[model samples]
Target: MAALEISKATRRIASTYPSLVLFQLARFFLVLATEMQAVAVGWQVYEITKRPLDLGLVGLAQFLPGIFLFLVSGHAADRYPRRTLLVLCYCGFTLCSGSLLFLTLRGLHSVYPIFAVTVLLGVVRSFNGPVSRAFLPQLVSGKDFQTAVAWYSIFIQSAVILGPSLGGLVYAAFRGPAAVYTLSFIAAALGAMSTVAIKAQSNPRLGEPMSWKTMLAGFHYIRSERLILGSISLDLFAVLLGGAVALLPVYAREILKTGPWGLGILRSAPAAGAATMAALIAHKPLGHRTGSTMLWCVAGFGAATIVFGLSRSLTISLIALLLVGATDMVSVIVRQLFIQVSTPDEMRGRVNAVDMIFVGASNELGQFESGLTAHWFGIVPAVVLGGLGTLAVTALWSWYFPELRKTEKLHSPAP
Candidate 1:
């Protein structure tokens, strides 16, 4: 029955139009490798300094450039060939990874250089977000775009599940942490290569010229689009406050009393959960009441974070982490679908870039918040409070964004 259902779903998608399955697959590999590298960097930095501040610094290193350049990057995406932009971004990322590998292999690395490289990566990622997101419409027909977005989220989070496991294995096999960085370099290079397979026509410009007025127009559009702004904001705060991903190294080392292998499992659990849920969504969508569903998923995510923070047993912690991952995965899918369905074609790039900035900030800033909070009140307390904060934010959003609260079904994308 499951196989039959999957076949039907595939046929349905085929009857509709081709989305960027290949591009999404390549993106999965890129995300998987980068995440592993990030965790390894966290572990290595913490091991060297044994300070929570160092971890926060790592996040700051990645976020500052992205925060500043996001609007410009969005404009560029709308003004250039997305495929070409991606090639440049991935090449830059691959080079960055290779440089780090070289530094590690030569044993000439210090935190300052890592910090510099991370900032560069952040800048590249800013361009990457708008370029990749803007290219989606070219890949699929209007009707299938929402589904495509959901599936893409699945591919992304699924990598999250697998990357850490491989990172751990690679780290253990090499007898040094440096090998993990090399693997990331190889993975990023492969992702860049695969992007060559994508075929897209460039439209570059859509009427207005670049200026401060145009940039402000993008912000203006977002502010006017209540649902889009609200949904993105809700997700930003929920993930920002509740996210403890940055502190996984600390947990693996101190609280959980586990090694690299344990760290991999802890890090991968959320992705694993997300991957599973995404698979299910591909076959059977959540269908209606998406807004309420998203809220519930976030509520679950917050609750799980609290549990994971408080639990002493590794088994219990893993379970809580898995739940957190699973719940957040649902939120991701719903949010992506909502955004794609509602957005106008010309505005997609700018809005998505806006979304990316909020997303990038929430994640990097959340990491900084988690690390500093953990440093001050201890890790467990910090995590628990974050969870509570997420729930509180969700409640506030529910009251404030009535459009999100009352949302029912995804509209078919306009032709």
Candidate 2:
């Protein structure tokens, strides 16, 4: 009788979260497609130009659209049906991927076309981030939100684990970028279809008027919440400095002396570590010392980045990247929980947009920064200095945001 009851309870939990499950599935395919696209573009562009700075240019081009559309995207997410908006965005992604395929098929010589496609993709990303993140809270109750986030991270990490590996294998087998782009297009199309199956939910702010004050609400809220500001800014600076992804091509060819297959392994290493940690976190959600734990993990991430920078052996580099991913996973979960749980439902879209802006700056802009630094200094020095800089930011954040440092639990006291 007890076993029967427990089984039924498990079924109930699963059934009660159908929307969240569907959302995760959609995100999985979409993320996988994007990751594959990244590997293809990185490898192709590097092969064409044989320049490190061009690698950074790719990131910069994608990032520019997000900066300009940050506020408007958030507002649109709030004002529109999120599910519909997401479907549209996924369609846009398909177009971008298809465009890339077309470019490769034409036997393109210049890297400019690739950059143009990336910029279009970036526009899609700017809207997608805010809407997708804001849509999550509507699917589940406050009590189950943290658990939902853990599962969400698991799906994302799983996609990360598979995407680059598949991308590399596809590229190496076909000896061209066309196959990879085709896969990306199919993935994006599927993602859109999956979202179409989700039960439609209404936005709380659907009738709200668009104004400067409304759009900027996210900025004000973050500024008022010290913990949010600290957590988001900490991620921004740490990742901005410690990010080694932009330099992977150089490492693959010049430093690691490996081909496309090796590059895929190196790219997927961090995702493997992150996925493992995400699984654990889902099983047992984070409890005590949430803030301090995140801080320590980020510091560890910096240490791992340093080790990766200094290593010559491929094995050591992979291990370092694994550690980097594991630590960053912890930070990501904690920060996401803080952002989602603390904000009001009506403002989640805008707030998440603001968060995405910070994320874009850290990730894409960080790639640009890494490229510039590598251009000025060699790759090894650029990475080592960035890692050191990450450590310094971690220390400063710990001191400056004592409330965040002392935060004991993930849940907020706010109603």
Candidate 3:
């Protein structure tokens, strides 16, 4: 009887969210390709220059395009066919991976070309981020949206857990970067094909004109909504301060004295933790006190980052990174839920675009920040201080955004 009940529930969810399943499968390949490229790029650049700032430059190169295109990209998502747009974007990614493969084949030593390729990839992501997110609401019913988000995260986290490790193994097995880049190109091509298979959904906002006002509307909506503003800002500042990912190569090479394989493991540790947490959430969704849970989880992320910064032992560092990933996953889910539930369907593209920019800042820009700080004051001190700063920001945000802190549930308020 129990087994039958479980089977029935599974069938119900599967029937209700078929598009989501396709989306996740496509995203899995996309993320896998991207992560493989990341591992290869990080290792190659660090090997050539041996400078931490250049590592940060990798992130900055990827982020700069979004700064310039945030408004335009958001508007495009609203006005364009999202599935077709996504197909094009993944095709662009395949080109980037192919270019990287060519560079590696030519015994390229200069980092400039690599940086340029990353910039082009960033341009693709600028358009990809908003459209990909805005397309979500079209995939599932309103009642199933939150569960879909959880499952969406599970797919992403699973990819994150697998991609880096696979990349590292391929690099090691072939004893070169070419193999990694080759695999990445293949994965990206598969992603594009999978996206092409998804059934098309009509864009309701297709008739909306590209005006200065329309481009700026997303920013205005977020600013007016305290919950949205607070949730997005909290993630921005916290992750901005706590971002230690860009420095992983340094830690793996110098601090932990590990090779590329170890670096891959280190890179995947957080995702492994996050994937575990995401699977749990998908099985049993968060019901109450979500706001406070988000706050605490972010705080835990900071604390874990601090531990990672201070650790010399590989075992200890992995554990710390695992905690960092798990805590950050909770914050990610909660923040995404807030953004999805609160915004109307028409505004999702632009709003998610704005949110993507914030995410870009906290990730790529934050990498630059970490690199700059590490250059000024050694790696350990820089990371430790950043973790401490994350803690401080959490405290300040909790006090300033009492509404976010006091919130009890994930349900959308009446329109």
TM-score of each: 0.87, 0.87, 0.88
lDDT of 2 at 138: 77
Alpha-carbon local distance difference test for all models: 0.80, 0.87, 0.87
For all candidates, what are the clash counts? Answer: 0, 0, 0
Quote the lDDT for 396 in model 1.
91
Candidate 1 lDDT by residue in tens digits, 14-97: 555433766886798799778878877887777777887898788777878877887888877766677888889999889888
Kindly list the per-residue Cα lDDT of model 2 for residues 101-141, writing each as its tens digit. Answer: 99999898999999999999999999999999988877777
By summed lDDT, which 10 consecutive residues of candidate 3 come out lowest?
Answer: 1-10
Give me candidate 1's TM-score against the actual structure. 0.87
Worst 10 residues of 1 by lDDT: 13-22
Number of residue pairs clashing in candidate 2, backbone atoms closer than 3 angstroms, sequence gap of 3 or more or interchain? 0
**Rank order (by lDDT, best first):** 2, 3, 1
Best of the two (2, 3) by lDDT: 2
Q: Choose 1 or 3, whichever is better by lDDT.
A: 3
lDDT of 3 by residue, 1-415 (tens): 6546535655777776676777888899999999988988998999999997898799888888999999999988878788989999999999999999998898887999999999999999999999898888777766666677777888888888788788878987998889999999999998898888887456466458889999999999999999899989999998888889879999999999998778978988998889878766766778889899998998899999999999999999999999998899899988888988898877888999999999877886677789899999999998999999999998999999997889898875112
- Residue pairs clashing, model 3: none
